[model samples]
Target: MVGRAEFVSRFGGVFEHSPFIAERAFDAGDVREPMTAGTVHAALTKHFRAASQDERLGVLRAHPDLAGKLAIAGGLTEDSRKEQAGAGLDRLSPNEHARFTELNAAYVEKNGFPFIIAVKGLTKDDILRSFETRINHNVQDEFATATEQVEKIALLRLTAILPES
Candidate 1:
């Protein structure tokens, strides 16, 4: 197995761009000491400290677009992509695909960013449903939601990096 240091070194960049996430991930420790849920939670709590409303909103802005080409390539993990594609836009009935495309475009336009949700366990239909629901949120509500989603993503990453106990 890869040591903790190498694991952190390799994937730390994933969190570093976001101060809240980076600090949380870093606090989990080096290669020798694997991340724990406590560490992740502590980091998140610290980052959230005294954050202004706008600063909190900025966290949402920091997320990479979900369907944007660069986001697909840089932000998403290989497994996530496979899961998303397996749901297969291509397999969607022509009308469904067209609706998805339209929804995606409108969502991006409204949010000024790509729709993001932790898709680890969710099916394509679930994701589409989440998109529809979240797309209706006002900027402030969505900002809060995005941060919560980021926390979920961080937790997922933490599990991936830590050794199985």
Candidate 2:
């Protein structure tokens, strides 16, 4: 176990290392401690501090199209990926998968980036509906949405990183 000074230094390092995460870490001041192992807030604050928005979104943007891509490395936590996979979209019926493919393609074509959403606690239906709903957002609107999603994701991650005592 880390001593308080070491923990504080390391914990602060989590913020200094990544701007996106640092922003979130600052918001989670109540839980920012090395002792907060296993809590979602700490994990997110640490992870976000170390990752870029693109990297974080890449993790949140799980899809067959990105399955074989290496660019998404360092994008998301292992737990988040597992949660998203279990969300059942990967098991969508053939027709549904095809529709999703089309939508994914169109979204990428228009935005120059993949559609991103945090799938941690959302159902498959909600995930699909979110795709449809968010597709209509303009670039500026979508950017805001993405940031908001990131914050929400950070909160969820924090909960996991630091379970309530």
Number of the top lDDT candidate: 1
- When summed lDDT is taken over every stretch of 10 residues in candidate 2, the lowest stretch is 63-72
RMSD of each: 4.7, 6.5
C-alpha lDDT values of all predictions: 0.57, 0.54
Q: How do the residues 1-165 of candidate 2 rate in per-residue lDDT, one tens digit apiece?
A: 444444344433222123344344445453433545445344554555366767655543532232212223434335445555667654567676667778778877766566666676677788778889988989777766765665565555445544454
Instruction: Write one digit per residue (lDDT tens) for candidate 1, span 1-165.
Output: 455465445554443244544444445542233445455444554555445666555655565544444433455545445435554532456576566677778876786655667767766688778888888999767766776776676566556755434
Badly placed stretches (over 4 Å) of model 2 are 1-77
**Model 2, residue 86: displacement in angstroms?**
3.2
TM-score of each: 0.64, 0.58
lDDT, candidate 2, equals: 0.54
Assess candidate 1 and give its lDDT: 0.57
Lowest lDDT block of 10, candidate 1: 24-33
